[model samples]
Every structure is written in structure tokens, then in C-alpha cells.
Target: MKVKAILIGAIGIILLFGILLTPKLKTVLKTTPSDEFIQLMYDGDVRELTQEQLKQYKDDINQELIKLKHRQSFEKIYLSLGKIASLEEGYEDSNNYLLNVISPGSHTNKMIDLKVYETLAVNYIAMGDIEKGYFYFNEANNVAYQLQDAELVASFYQLFSETLLNYTNHTNFPIYLLGEAVELTNDYYKKIQLRKQLASVYELNGFFDLALTEFIRALDMSVEKGYVDLEIKILGRLSLSYYSNQRYQDSIEVINRYFELSSDDPDLFYVSLWLHNHYYLYGYESVQEQLKSLEEATSNLSIEQKHQLSIFIDFNQVFFLHSDGQYEECERYIRKLEKLKTKTTISELTGLLIDKMKLDLDYDRGDQGIDYIKEYRKLLSDLQLTNDSVERKRLIIDNVLHHLLELGDYETVYQYTADLQKPVTQEITIINSIMNMIQNSSDSHYLAKNNITSMLLKLGSYVLSTLAGVGLTYGAYRYNSYFKMLKRKAKESTIFDPLTKTLTKEALYETLELEIELGQNELYYFLLIDVNDLSSYNESFGYLAGNKVLIEISNLLKIYFPNAYISRHYGQHFIVVIKKPNEEELLQLITSLINEISNNEKISAKRPITCCIGVSKGYLTNTLDIDEQIKLATKKLQISKQRGTGSCTL
Candidate 1:
């Protein structure tokens, strides 16, 4: 039913776009209602409802079909029934029936035929048959454009975009299709809607800064056109983008603007809850008053709206109570949230909150809290792949690590710390060092400050005496030091990049020269990786975050191909040369590395750090200059950027 709702929303826009391409359906040969009602089915014996209930539902649809007199009307009803059967009831055969009935040459409106083809594509994608799904999807798109109906084309593109984004493995194609939809529409609001939809897709892919830019563009249009509702929505999203990039002050300012614009709107309460959660630490009393006012204003909200608001409001209260050290009160609110878990999407957050509270309560009671530790560990294992590495998750995991240290559980602590360190920022190295220190200090007693000061003074005196003796012989050392300095500078100038520690361009060329002389027949593959949106990331999250990402990428490349010749070129691009015999193996390795870089959730917390890769393979020969190979790979990298931001061009 939600899928139906979404489909209606997307296609509903088609009519507004002025696409009147509805064709009539041909008459169905006399097939009585009792001949055969569509039997709904599911895979792996997973029935959504009992067989009897499904039969009755099909009977109702068939009865309605029987009442329709016109052939076109009957076909329309059949399409609706097919949609319900396939989407809501998991009827695979109903999809096939839909395709046959609304086949391209059939006597049906272009809109109905287009919908049927799109629906089939969506179903196939959902069922894990991407090749057939893409075939039908492309079929629907081609027909829409062929009809030369702007609205139909836009509609097909929009819904098809959603299907690909939500169900399939691909994202770039859908995003490109959405851009096409936006281009096809001249309507201001429709264009804005399409842009916002595109931004949501970007946001889901962890491209927050890109999403923010889109939101800002749409916000500008909303302001110019006096579209208050759309403006408020965009402001909300823009604020979240700011928050994710750690621009808290900007986030607060945007939230304040949103509050001013949406004071009397029905969505004000929900917006207030978002503000309360994010900005509560800034002004507890003010946020509390806002919550109270929103609660008193709840009578204006619908039942469903109230449920949604209550879930967040209560969750925020749990956070507030926990912050205030009201563990008992926090538990009460946590329990309240758990009860409403089935009614909300915040169930996972609630479970995390509960686990955190239990750990704190157990610690307060002076127990080891082993059960709480085990519970949190299990939850972390289950959620690690699915959840982003946000600050809250880090704090929770770090707190657990600190608890483990307190309990002298170094074995468990070591395992979690090691696992957490891989994707975390370089700052985690400090934590690792601290853990090592703690583990070493566990069997020792603390030295008194006075005793340590005395020992430090004795060691310092001895070091100073040795240094003074050495300083007496400085004349003899100066000439040798000057020669060493020259040698060090010469080596530094020739070999590694100062910033990234990879090979310099000159060094890479020199290596290429040597390889050509010795291994001319060897297959050398050149991989060029260009970080996408890195400049935007620097603008949004500061240059430090951008530098961290670059360093991380360089480190990852080193780890993956220790023997390869790697270089950090000017800007946010890295070049790696490897002598693998198989081109397919090289491409596969490059693809996996690109995916790893793109989906690194730790870096994604500040900004979605993504990169495009271009891989070119050839033999190391005297005639083929390294610069020419780099140029070829750079050309492919540029093409990859055009095709899609985070794609690979081979």
C-alpha cells in the first residue's frame, strides 16, 4: 500500500505536466469472474496473509472488474488489481499477467501501458533479477520519450528513478534519469520537487554536501516564488547538512529561521522535536519550553502526526534525562519509548539508548556490568554494517571500551579497539596508545609525583652533561652534519611526496624508466583515483577534514598494494602503478577499492568521501612514456566524473 502511495505520488505529477497520452484498452474476450481469480503467491512460503484472505481479496477485485461495462474501464481496473496483487501481496505471476495485458501493441492508454511496463521493471528488480529489470525499465523509458510527451517522460523517469534508487544496486543511472526529468519540466514547483527528490537520493548515498547544495538551490527558488512550505522543508534539510558537517552554529541559525517560518504550520511540532534533539545542550530550558508549547498545541495534529511527534519527543526526553543524571527517570522514558517501538522508526535508537542507560546504571551500582557489555557488543555487531559511524555511535562504543578497561578486560578491549581502528580517523591512534599504556600499567603501582620528579631531574642532569660534552666537540661535527644535511635534502627532493609520503611525479617517472629497461614485457597497470567533491567538502567541513580523507586514501592504497608505485598528484588525485598480469584481476581490485573508499562510513560522518577510478593497462615499453599513460588514465578519470561521480572508467 505504501508502494502504491509512492507510485501514485510520482505518476500523479505526470498529469500536471500536461502529458495527455492515455490510450484506450481493447475489450477482453468473455472471461467470467468465476473462471479463475488471480491466485496470489510468495517465495519461500512466506505468506503475508492466509490463503483464504488472499482469495477473498482477489474475489473483490474480480467482482469490481465484472461491474465495469467499457473495455477501457475494465482494463484500468485490471491494472489496479494487478498492482495490488504484485506489490501488496507478493504475487509474481500477477506481474507476468500485467505485462501480457498491457503489452506495447495492446489497445490501452499510453499512460496505463507505461505504468504496467514500469511496474514490471520494479517487480523484477525487487525479485533480484537486475538484468531483466533493467531491460523492462529501459523499455518503459524509451517508449515514454518516443511518444514525445513531456509529462509522460517526466513521470516515467521520476518513478523509475525511485524504483532503481530504492530496490536495485545502481544509483548513478537513476540520478541521471532524475536530472533528465528535471530538464524536461518547465514548471517551477515540479522542477523544485524533482531537485529535492534528487537531493534525497544523494543524501541516502551519504553525499550530504551535494544534497546540501541542491537544497540551497531549491531554497533560493522557494524564497523567490514565495513557496513557504517548500522553503521550510528545504531549511530543515539544510540545517541537517550543516549539523552533519559540524557547522553547529549554522545549523542553529537555519533551525531558527525554520521556526520563524513554520510557527503556525502543522509540522511545527515535529520540527521542534528535531531542534530539541540537536540544540538541547545549547539552551535546555528554552528547548524544554518549546517542547511544552508543542505538546499543548498537539490537539491540532492528526492521530498519526501525534504518534510521530511523540516518538521523537519522548526519545529526546530520554536523552535529556540521561544527560541530567536522572537514570531512574531516563529508564522510565526509555521504557515508554520501547513500548512505542513498533509504531516508530526510532526503534534502533531506542535500543541503543536503553543499552547505554543499563550500562551506566550497572556502573553506578558498582557491578562489573558484564551482561550489559555483552548486550552492547552483540548490538554493535548487528548494527556495525548497517549504521553510519556517527559521533554518538563512537561515544557509545568508546564508553564501552572505557568500561572494559576499568574492569581489566584487556582481551575483549583489544579486539574491539582493533576492529574500530580500521575505519576510524587517525585520532583513534591516540586511543590505541592509551589502551596500550593502560594494559602495561595494570600490573604496576603508581609512582609518587615527588619521586618521579627526582628521577626526572637525575636523568635530565645526565642528559645535559652528555649534551654539553657533545657540544664541546661541535667544530668536528659541523662539517659532517652539513654533508649529511645535503644528502638528506637530495634524497627528500628525489623520492617521496612531503605531504602524503607517496612517490613524487619525478620519482614515479624514474621508476618507470627503470621498469622499461628491465621489464619491458611486464604488464603495468595505471590507476588514477580522483576524490569527488573534495573541494566542496573542504568548503563545508574545513580543510582539515579534507586532508584527513586524502591521508586515509593514501594509507589505504599503501595497505592494499604495498609493492605498487603510488603517487599523490596535485589536487585530490592519487596514481598507483602495479604489474599484475591479468587486466580483469586489476580491474576487480580497483573496483573493490573504490567501493571501500566510497562507503567508508567513518569519513562519511563529516562528508561522504567518494572517489572515481580510472584504470589503464599496457606493457612497460621504451616508446610509451609514463606521462602519456598518465594522460590516458586522467582522460578516463574525467570521463568517469561525467558518467557518474563515484564510478570507475576502465
Candidate 2:
């Protein structure tokens, strides 16, 4: 699943870059629209709808525009219509409306016009008029460079590549373009797209090392952005990349981490994908046990979910039969696969899996499947080819399809640029709107005929009114933004320590209290962990180094006891509480953590940073206070510290 996610990212990068370089066919009305919002509309990020629903949506926009008294606002309505047309794949209508619209040529409009040119380029490329497409593409590129807009530049790199892939056999070219795009943008989401594309290109070309590098980069970005879905996808890809690179243990470890991250995944799709990856890594028997566990975990699924799970379960059964050398059973399961093929589009991943199953069947059949083996090997060779004509041709279409899929996934994450100004606010937006109107107006004679005093008076009043309106609007925006930030911070601070991100002491106690009240019949263990020589390390190597050690140790603890309640009180002191673990289990966990921490090469430390662990275990009840348990743990911690660094007392 993780591998698939990483590959998806790679494919996303390819698609984005493919269209970005394909042709700049997408044209929009010369109006104020953000690059992100423009991309969203172009990518059909708005909710998918039937033809009737789409017409109604367009009618709604038009009706809303009709109610507006301002003539200037009408241009915005046309732009909105153009965007909708684009979404509906009515490229000709979108182009005509965007190109024929009466628009102002102000700087803001120029930026929008750049997008229009790019849109037109894509439309043209899709229509098979590559010459016209490239012309518009160049025009858009020129405008983008002239404006010095990094975001637009980044977007172009992504979108142009996607467009190009539709019409040409450019398998590896999108990677370079996307890599440039990655360099141009600081936006986390954008970089994620670029890196994923580049990685996908590399992975498709059999450049596993390069693919892994980009996947890892994208994975880091996903983690930083707190995009759980993206993180899961990246991890799955990372694990698969590891597997492809022949790092089996690394692959297994990453798959385990995927499970840890998605323990409570609410989606059946996510669970099914994870299970698929698990089957590949752990084989049939282990996956059967996993499926049983999953069945229990997802027992309360909806009817729709049950249907999806059934499909996935059947798919897994095919693999299980094949792995078990039950050739007849596998042959029966092949019918299920054939039925599945009719239900969904045959994706590259699906094709690959099908081929593998066929190969397995052939291996079992000996000379009976010789021709099948030859054909299968040939197909695999084409897919893994570095330099082949068939591979090149396939990449052109594949890259574009991948880009479209990426856009859909991106919509799921970003939802059409939430930060874009509302249509109401955008219509009157700023001084630019007024300036564009004045500059483009045909009645310049009327303005010239007015007396200087009269014109000055009108201009002053208009400027003052616009400025006042802008100030109030900006003030409201800031206030709301700040309020949201405050709310987020307040919530975060209550549950987490500001620096370490571990649970706050209060939060830890609350968790313990809640668990105790649940009346569980089990022993709960509280452990106090103190970093040995951390202060000395801080003094010798700098505070940043000490913080690094703290963070690394905290992460290790989290990994070792993901379900446990953990907290940080003093700068380098941590409290950990877990339930009902045997002595051997506890020792192994601690020993593994200690070994990893001491040998940590990622941290730039001169010597090993060790820890003292003190533990206290007892039944949770009203008779025993949580604070008393901590005190006992702290006492044992003091003993461990006295004994030596890396010492533990229970």
C-alpha cells in the first residue's frame, strides 16, 4: 500500500509535469484568479456531477451574476463559467468564452491571462493540435517568467509536463521539469507533487535508488504537513521502494510502521490497501491471520464498505491460492480476477499483479504455459525498459493518466484552495480592479473632458473608499485567522508539551485517571526516563544537539510504546505508562530502544546519549493515586541514574 502511495506520488509528479510541458492550451478570462484556485478548477477539483447537475451549477453562477448591479463584476461571472466549462471537459466552449470575453489588460489580468494561455495550451494538446498548443504554452511561459511568480512557475512545471505526456513519447523528460518545479516552490504540497512525479519517473525507468530518494523526500513533506493520507501513501511507497531495492528487512519494518500510523484507519479502502501490501511482505498464512484481525476491527462497516472489502478479500484469496501451490484453486480464483477487471479500469498496478499471477500459473503448468511465460516476460521487460520504443509510447499516455489521477488525489487533500477569496470579496477585491476598469474603458474622452478639480475630487473619494473597505476586510481576515491560530494553539498546548510534542503532564495524568476509572483488571506500569549527561551534552555540543537527542529519544519511545501515554515535565525528563506487559516484553522493548538510541548515527553527537529508566507497576484503582505511581517511578529512576548511564531499575 505504501509502495502504491509512493508510486502514486511519482505518477502525480509525472502527470503534473507531463501536462505542464505538453501544451499551454488552458485559457481563462483576463481577471483576478489565484494560480492554486485556477489549477483546482482546471483539475476538476469541484465535486463531480452529472450533466444535469453541471448545467444547474453553471446556471447558479449566472443567476448570481445577474443579481449583481456592478457591470465590472460580470467579467468574474464569465471567468467562473469558463472554469466550469473547463471542468466539464468542454474545452472549445471554455476557450471561446475565455478568449472572446471583454477584459482589462492590467497586471493582475495579465497573470490571469497567463493561466488562460496555459489552459488553452492544454486544450489544444488534448485536441491533437500540438503546434497551436506549444504556441500558447510558450506565451504562458513568457508571461509566467515576466511576472516572476514562483508559484505559477512551479505550477507550470507540473501542469505543462502533464499536458505534454498526452501527445508525445516523453517518459524521462517530465522528471527534469518536475525537479525544476520542486526547486521553484516552497509550498509543501507543491513539492510533494513534484518529488512524487520525479520519483515515479525514476521508479518506472528502473532507477530504484533515485525513486527511493524522491519518495523519502515526499514522505518527509507529508509528515511535516500532517497529511495522514499522504503519509500513509508515502510510507507504503517507501516500503515498496525498499523492497524493490532488495532491502527486505527495511521493507518489512516500513510496512510495520504503516500499521502503527493507521491503527484506527476509518476507511475500508485504506485497510484493504494496507492488507494487500502486508500479503506481499508476510505471505499467505500471516495475511490470513491479519485478515481475521481486520474483519474484527472493521466489523461495523457500512454496506458500501462491506462490498469494497469483499472485492479486496476476493483479490487476496487469489494470491493466497497461488502462494499455496493450489493451481486448480488459483485457476478458479482467476475467474474472480476476470470479473474484477470488468468492474474497474485496468490500472498499471492491476496489470502487473495479473501478470504475476499468470506467471505463477504458468510455472505450475510447465511446458503448457511456455508461450504465456514468453509473452509475460516480454511485457515485464517493456515495463522495466530504460530505452525502448514501446515503453516510450506507453509512458506518453500513462503519464497523462497518472497526472489526472494525481489531480483527483490532490483535490481530496486541498479541496480547491481553501485560502482563495470568496467570489463576493474577489469581485471588488482591491485598487487593481478599479485601475483595470479605468485603463481598459473605451470612454477615455469622458474622463478627459472632466475638469481637473472635479476628477481629482472623484479620484480622491474613490481611493479613500476603496482603501477603507480594503482595511476593514483585511482587518477582519487577520482577526479571524489569528483567532483560529489561538484556538489551535490552546488545544495543542493542553494535550502536548510545546517543545517536545509529548503529552503534557496534566494530559498524562488525565489519561491515567481515565484508564483507572475504566476498572481494567490489569497491572499498569509507570516509567520515568531521565537523559543521562544531557545537560553536559548541551553544554559541550550546544542546546540544539541536546534538543535533537531529546527529540530522537522521544520518537524512539513513541515507536516502542505507541499506545502508551507519555509526557515530558522537566526539560529532559519523560513519563511513560503502559499496561499488562510481561517482564520479558518490557525488557525487550527497553533493550531494543536503548540499543537504537546508543547507536543512533543520524544525530550529530560526539558520544552516545544514554538514559536512566525507573519503573513502578501496580493495579489501577481508587485506592492508589496516579501521582503516587509517578513518585515511585521517580524514586526508581534516581536509583538507575546512580547506578550508571543506560541503567534501569524496576
Candidate 3:
């Protein structure tokens, strides 16, 4: 699952960069979109999408726009169309795209609304309208941060950060988001890529020491994992990072290793950079000789590579000519470099050199512009440049389908995304309830048949306590220790949440079963409540903090629905069955519950709390299957969770 999540993240981010980040195409994809990917894109069954289809997505947008011109209504495909328009349309014309993104009838659908808010935010940031960007980004991020899946929320942070990379003055924001992304992923390669991305952002702003740390870490992991291809490029960037920090000797040594490992195909940009940096150490003549050879080296290069290389060569020549006391030639070369910037977009970091260049050939803000990231474009290429393997191709196809469709599939979105959850078993919950009754109650006769099991559990607890007393050392666990506390809870016929003291699944089922057996007709509203990313709460705070959240939710349940039957249904879910006086009263209760959850002193003081609830109401009868009703309510919960934007009821 960890590997799969990373794969999904990599594929989704890469595809997103192609479509949403760049807006304009950079390199033409070597591999075509898989037939499966294309079909999924058009069929709208896909929840993820591949970069290969981005060109198609772009072309289709224009085609769809042409088609929409004649049509009276076109809300079904509005999300995709609006996404591209929000980007392609400049900030001055943003209102039209905003209108297109948020059609009047589209406000009810939270998922679509989320995508709209996110796109508006990203587009505004890219356009340097930071005020509007901050507004929408906070709105969208709040919605996404409240999603139930930790992976999806992490994915969104990365997506937002990566989008900010191409253009935006939000420096620390990308670093923070990428750091969040790095911690969330488990895949070695993905971590390396994310770190490189984080390092690249640092490099962009002259944070060479910080960039070096990440680069070295990525290098170590790449070598340990035998990813020679990635290691070779990291060496080139490390050389530049060293030079940026005035470690000239170290830079030369790293550059030597870069060449040694690179063998026949050295990176052209770094090759030119090396010449300028090592002018004194390698001798003016030796550097001059290498510069002559550099022109012949590009004979076999592509047009785009040649364009980017030409800029790199001119950039270095500006500095070299300046050092040689050839001020006039240096000025001419600087002018030439400025013209080269408009030719192609492949330089990545070198594209910034001209912007920061001064009349004296020095860079502004103390940032050595020429020393910024060269590995960034290559890093993304190594990670997402190709989709060669059949399995990987399918992974890209499926993941991309869902990522794009995350705007909302109203019907199947929950089924696709929610399937990633690591659910708590009802058996374990029942056992917790069972042990609670045995431990808290006076009589042991009801469960005396399970004496041996009870004895073993007691012995295990004693052993764990003894070990803790002895101060046993262990690494931090990835998940919460909630399960470890389950044995301490109470109940038999009535199952209870171990921490919250609310009912559990078994107790709710038993209650409904008894009601049906007694032949009672009742009018009740069933609400399924779920907290978003509860494990994150555990990981961020402690297990105790997470328990507090569950307890607080239970408290809110009692406050809002005092007459209702409330249960902490398994994991982060809560179930509440109540007899409502009227629709208006139920709405008020739900609104208050959501408001309290968000602003509560106990739960939201440290981290803002958010939840999604699914409400189902009907007249219950002896003939009606309660399980079916529960299933319907659960399905509604899934819907609300998927269409997340604070606590929602469907």
C-alpha cells in the first residue's frame, strides 16, 4: 500500500505538472497515452490521470470550448474546462474563468467546488495575484486538509507546492509543503525526488547550505538503493551547491566525480558551468580548451537542448569575459543571454539567471543565480519521464484517471478513494467491549467461559508494563496505539467505544435487532460521522491527543443529540440514531455539531477539527431490514466524506 501510494503520488504530480503547472508544454512526451488512459479520460470513469494525456486534455479543452459555444448547457465537463481556462486566461480576465468554474448549480457539489477553489487559488498564485491566491488556497486547503485519507491530503499538499514552483513568490510555502510530502511518502525513489524538489526550491532562493543537506541525503539514498542514474545527476548539482557556498575546492572534487560517473554522456549545462567555476584551478588555457570542445559536443543534441545549452554557454561567458577584463564582450554576451531566455523553456533554473543578472554581472539578493538547481528537470524526468513498463503504465493510467476525476464522481468517488483506508475490525471492537464488561462489572459469570483468554490478556498487559518500566527503546510507530488500549474498555450486549464511552457497532446492531424483534415502528434519523485523517492526528500529536478528539466528538454528540443513540462505530467514524422533532430542528443540531467541532476548545485548540456526516432518515418498521438502512446511511457517509468541505451531510 505504501509503494502504491507513492506510485500514485508520483504519477499524479507529474501529470498535474504537465497540465496544470506548466500550462505550456515543455518536452513532447516520448510515450503516447495508453489507450486505457485515453478511454478513461473521455469516459469519465477514471479517478487518476497520466501526463501523456495532458496534451490530449489540452487539445480537448479547446475542442470542448468550441463545442460548448453552441450548446445551451455544459456543466458535466465544466471542471476540466474551467481548470485550463483558469490558467490560460490571464489574471485580468480571471472573472470569466471563475464564473465558468463555479456554475450556479455547481455550488452544492463540494468536490467540484473544492477543485474550483483550488484551481482559482493556484492560477492566481501563478499569476502573482497572491491576495486572491491566499484566499482560495486557504479555502481549498482547508477542504482538502479535512479529507479522511491522509495520503490524499498529502498528495494535495504536494500538488499545491509543485504548482507554486513554476511561478510564485511564495517561497517558504513550497518548502513546507514538500517537507510534508517527503514525510508522508515511503517509497525510496519518491522521497529522493521530493527531497530534490525541496532542495531545488531552496537553491532557487540562495539557500545553498539547506539545498546541500537535502542533495546529500538524496545522494546517499540513491547510492544505497543503487540508483546510479539519479546519483550521477545529484553529483552535478552538489558540485554547483558547493561552489555557491564558496567551497571551490570541494566543488571541483565533486565535479570530477560527476565526470567520472557520467562517463560518455555528461550533463551539458553542468559541463559549461564547470568550465566557468574552475577557471583558475584548471588554468585559463585548460578552461579555454574545454570551451572550444563544448560547441562540438552539441552536434547530436536536440533543438530544445541546443537552445537551453546556448543560454547556459552565454551565461557562463558573461562571467568568464568579465573576469578576463573584457567588459565590452561581457556586456554583449549578457545581452545575448537575455535573448536566449525567450527561445525555449528547458533551462529550468538557468531561466532565472538573466532575471537576476546585474550590469556588473553579479546576481541580486546575494543568490548566485548560476548556482541554482540543474538537477530539477532531470529529477522529474527520471521519476516521470517515461511510462515504459506495462504495470507502471497502468498505474499511471489508473492513478491519473482518479486524480483528475477527484473533482467529484458523485457516484463512485468514495468507493475509489476510501478503499485505501486501513479499517479497524469489528471483532477487535467487540473484544474491547467484551473486556470492558469483564473488567468494570462485579460479576465474571457472564464471560467465565473465556477465563483462559482473560488470564492471557492480563499476563500480556503485565509483561508490557514491566517492559515499559525497564525503559525499552523503540522507534516511533507509524499508526496510533488505539488498538493497544481496546482491552481496557467495557460491555457485552452493549458494545462501547473504549475511550469515548459511546456505543460500538455490535451494540447498535443489537439495539436495532431488538427493536425489529419487538415489532416497534419508529421514526429515526441515522447519522454517520467521520473525522478526517485521524491517524495524522495521532502521528502529529500523540495517541492521547487523538483520544481527546474522539472523546470531544462523543461529547458533542451528547450535546447536540441528547436523546440519540450514539456509537463510535470503528476507526474515526461515529454513528448516531435519533428521533428528530422536525427537519428544521435536525438541521440546527447538525449545524451546531459541525460548528462546535470546528471551534471546540479541547479538540481544535491545537489543530482545527473538521468532519463529514451522512444523514439518513426514514420510518423504521418490523419488515424493513435495519442492516439495509445502515448500509444506505453508510453510503451517504461515504458520499459526504468524498465531497468534503467541512462537515457535510448527504
Candidate 4:
């Protein structure tokens, strides 16, 4: 019994020693900050880290950030880890480290600055804080501008514009910004990208003329650059834009062009297949042949590619099948997309949303279609995702309008028409009032002359009759002219820039105001801009060039605050009323605008451009009498300029 007890004690002591000294046991009990960090990074790289592991790693690094004397090394490791965290969608951890751990001054490194800003911008975008997202995007652009790297600058604009385009009100702004980017960069590939983005923006804003221009430009650029992938993508956009504009022949032509260009590449070929399917659904004569071709082409693709293609092809197939009265096939395709939706990543959701909507439409379930669209919108809203995808909302709106019109729901249509007619009605009232005043003054003068004639007694009747006849004729002519003017004004106000017909600033402003009024109050803010360099721009660029600059600035303002109210307040000055903007976001926006204007070779290459901005709390009142506010804002803006270039006040 004594021998057995001794053996047990020895075995137990050995086990205890192993627990104390083993590498795994030591790692668990006595892990150094560096060891844990390295391990965390490894786990992240290998995709084995849990949310708790990520949180702990972030905490450890943040603590190390305070104690580390060698900040240069610390920043590198910290940013490196943050990048990994960002990839894993640990946005909170990544943002905390980027925003809090690293010194702002340490962001002097261009690459690091780019990464940090991009990550932060994306995070803010993910959180549905577009104001902050744009702010960081502008920060990223500033860094790229500092580097004098045109490609990077173009890329930043592309990303920023894309984010802005996700919101309906901000769609036009991205197009304008992308145009600026196109002017700045000489690289064919970058130019193609800018054009593609511009096309998407224009399409979203219902600017078919501009959309077509951009799509053609992109196609040309892609051809020039020999980028088949880009060519295919642009072709797809072109087809959609054409389809939206009801240019069915042009849509078919572009889709065919895409099919030809992508014939050699399977991925591109699959895209072509999708385009062909859409073309068929849009009522092209050659759709049957195209469908046959699509099936044959898709058959040769790998299982994964086929599955991916089905995600798009199947959805489109549902539309075509439904149109052809093949309800069973449509249901099958709907089920396929429904199953695919379960496994889709957030990036794929937009496309999936589109597919689901088509399925709903094909099933003869208009209510279901509308419901799906609303759900899709909510998903986008929740994810804070923005891009060309949001343009789908316009289609949904059109669909709803069509359904209402079909059901002879005139009350609903009238309500929509009233909403559409409000701006026109306002303009007409103003113009008619001015015309009435002129007519009344003329009538009074004629009456005074007639009274003088009546004093003569004999010619009184003749004079009165002559005067009445002339007045009636003139009034009739004036009435007709006023109607014509109203029509002209309505068209101009909706489509043309008030200052320059190249674009419509008023339309842009009204759209912004509508967005603010329509959106959830807690989510938006405004930034009122007043330009300081219009005179300089006009003087240097010649009057035409000056007009171009005004157009360019208007376009830039549109891009920078797509979801915000942007308008030409007066001569060489503008106002942007944003939604739910914080102070830091306002500063970032001001800084970006300043940098963009100052760095733009088109505007600033020959002479520098400067702007002073004021940030207000929320959407400005339509009745608030903008004259005094603008003057005050302009005066404050001048003070900021006197202080230095690129200054702003709130």
C-alpha cells in the first residue's frame, strides 16, 4: 500500500509539472501581448478567429498603443492588424483601432492613410452614416491628391461617387464627380472606370442623354485600352440605359456587341448570357436566337460558373418565361434564386434583390413584387449599401405607377401627378403674377386715355369700343404666350440648369430638399456652400471656360453631397443643405471640396480655386427667406477665406 501511494504521488507531480511547462499551457496562462497579437493575427489569416478573439486582440493592441515607445513600428503592426480585422468584417474593432489607436499625424504615410481612410469610409457606409462615409472618402481622395497619383484619385472618386449614387437624391452628383475625375486622369483604364460610374449615375438620375454619352465614352475608352472585361461591363450598362430610355433597338445592339466582345471569356460570356436574356424580355425580335445561344454557351461553363450564371440567368429566365406565359418555368427559376439568396453575400444582395423582384413580377403578384422591392430597399437601407443598385428603386416606382395606372387608380395617379406638378405650378404662378401686373398697368393707362376721350363726349363711344377691342386682343395674345412660357419654364426647370442649361441646379436643389423632407429626420444634415473663386475662374478660363467651371463646381457639389440639397444660390456661389451631418463630417466634406477644387487641373491648373462653406443643422426652410441667410453665409465665408485657403464655418 505504501509503494502504490508513492507511485500515485509521483505521477500526479509529473502531470502538474507538464501543465506548468507545456507550450500550449504556458500560452494559455502566461501569453505576452506580442504572442497573443501574433497568434490573433495568425488566427485571422487562417479564418479561425472568433468574435471574442477579435475583440481581445483589438484590446491588447489598443493597450500596447499607449505603452509602445516606437510608434512607427506600432502604427505599422496596428494598421496591419486593423486591415485584417477589416477584411473579416470586424468593422467596429477596425474602426476603433484606426480612429483611436493611431495618431492622426501618423497617417502621413500615403498607403497607410489610404487604407485607414478607405476602411473608415467603408465602415461608416456600412453603418448607414453616408455623411461620415463621404467625409472619409474625401479624406482618402485628399491623401491620393497629396500623392499626385491620378489613378488612385480616380479610384477614390469612383468609390465615393458609387456610395453616393446608392441614395436616390444623390445620384446626379456622382455622375458629375466622375466627369471631373475623367478630366483629371489620362489613364485609359481609369477613364473607362470613371465613364462607367458616370453612366450609372446618369442612368439613376434619369439623365439618359448624359448616360448615353458616358456609356459610349466608356465603351470607346475600353476599346482604346483593350480591356475586354471593361468593354463587357460598359456594354451591359449601355444596354440598360438604352432599355430604360425605351431605345429597344439600341439596347439590342449593345447587348449584341457585348456578346461578341465577351465570346472568348467564360465569365464575360455568362454576363453576355444575362444581357441576352434581358434583351429578349425587353421584346427584341432576335431574342429566341439569343436565348438559344445563351443556353449553349452556359452549358460549357464549369459548375461553379454555371451556378453563378444561374443566379443571374435564372432570374432573367423567370422574366422571359413569365412573359411567354410559362408560369411553371418561372416558378422554377424563382425557387432557384430563392435558394441562392440564402447563401448570398451582402455584395450579391443587390442583384438578388433585382432577381426576386422580377420573380415577383413574373408570378403575376404585383403586390408581392412591391413588397419584395420594399424589403430590398430596407435591406439596402440597413446595410448602408449604396451604388448603382439603388437606381432599381426608380424601376420599382415606375412599376408601381404602371400598376396604378392600369387599375385606373386616378386618385393615386393624381396624387403622384400633383407631387410632380408642384414645381411647375409654383413657377407658373410666379410668372403669371408678373404678367398680370404688367397687363393691369397697361389696362389702367388705356382706361385713363379713354376717360379723357369720354370728356370730349362725341367720340366717347368710338374710343371706348376701340380701346376694349385692342385690350381684348392683347390679353388673348398675352394669355397664350404665358401658357407657352409656363411650358418652357417647366421643361427648363426640370431638366436644365437655371444658370446654364448644361445641368439644372434648381432641379438638383429641389431633389435634395425632397430627399431631406422624405427621409428619417435623425439621419441627415446640410452644408451650405458659397463659392469664392467664380470671378477668378471666369477671368482665367475665358467666359466659356468660366461657364465650364461653374458647371464643374455645380457638378462637384452634386457629387460631394448627392443626398444633400445643392443649389446655385447666386453669382459664383452655391449652397448645399446636407442631412444629419456631424461636425467632423462637415469638416471632412469642406476639406474634400476644397482639395478637389484646388487640385482640379481643369479649374485650378491655370489658377487656384477656393471655396468657403457654412454648415447648418438641418434642411433649410423654403419660406425662411434665403436672401439674408445667403448674404450672412457669404459674409462668413469671406471671413474664412481671409483666414486662409480651404476654410469653412458652421
| Each prediction's whole-model lDDT (CA) | 0.64, 0.64, 0.60, 0.58
lDDT string for model 1 (212-317, tens) is 8888888899999999888888888777677756777777788889888887763544365465545544666666787788689776879888877777687677
Better of 2 and 3 by lDDT: 2
Deviation (Å) of 456 in candidate 3: 40
lDDT of 4 by residue, 1-650 (tens): 99999999999999999987898776455644645554443232323557786667667766766766654656555665665577576778878777753465653467667756866876777556756766676566555544655555555556556655453234433544476578666677767877787777656545568778878977887888789888888887787777767676677677778768776653544455455545555554455566668678669879888877666666567666677766776677777667655676635545545554553454364332144334433443433343444455555545554444333343443444334333223223322332333334434443343322123234434333432443233221112223334445557666555554433455655564565476544443444565665776577656656666677787877777776656665567666655566668767877888889878887666677777776445334552423445555666676777777677776
For model 1, the superposed segments whose C-alpha errors exceed 4 Å read 1-64, 67-77, 84-96, 102-112, 126-132, 165-170, 268-312, 321-329, 339-650
On a 0 to 100 scale, what is the lDDT of residue 30 in model 3? 25
Candidate 3, which segments miss by more than 4 Å at Cα? Answer: 1-55, 58-76, 86-111, 203-207, 226-229, 256-266, 293-315, 326-358, 361-650
Per residue, candidate 3 scores C-alpha lDDT tens digits across 442-466 of 4455234333234424653443343
Worst 10 residues of 4 by lDDT: 471-480
Residue pairs clashing in model 1 are 23-109, 23-110, 25-107
List runs of model 2 lying over 4 Å from the truth.
Answer: 1-57, 64-79, 99-108, 127-132, 162-169, 221-230, 266-283, 339-650
Tell me each candidate's RMSD, in Å, in order: 30.2, 25.8, 32.0, 33.0
User: How many clashes (backbone N, Cα, C below 3 Å) per candidate?
Assistant: 3, 44, 15, 16
Residue 64 of model 3: what lDDT? 54
Lowest-sum lDDT 10-residue window in model 2: 412-421
What are the per-residue Cα lDDT tens digits for candidate 2 across 1-650?
Answer: 99999999999999999789665444323333323334455443543456786687687776666666655555545666766686677888988766754345522366566767777877776665756766677677556645656666677767767665544333343554576688777777767867877886667545677898899989888888888888787777677667656676677678777878877763444455556566677777888899888678768989878877776776777767776777787778677777667786766556555655665566555534155424543554445432223334443324322332222222211221123223214222322333443445465554454232233235645643543464234322212233334445557778987657899998887777777678776788898988887888999987767776788788888989998888997888998888888878998888777677878885435787778899998877754567788889999998988898888899
Q: Residue 409 in candidate 4 has what lDDT?
A: 43
Clashes of 4: 16
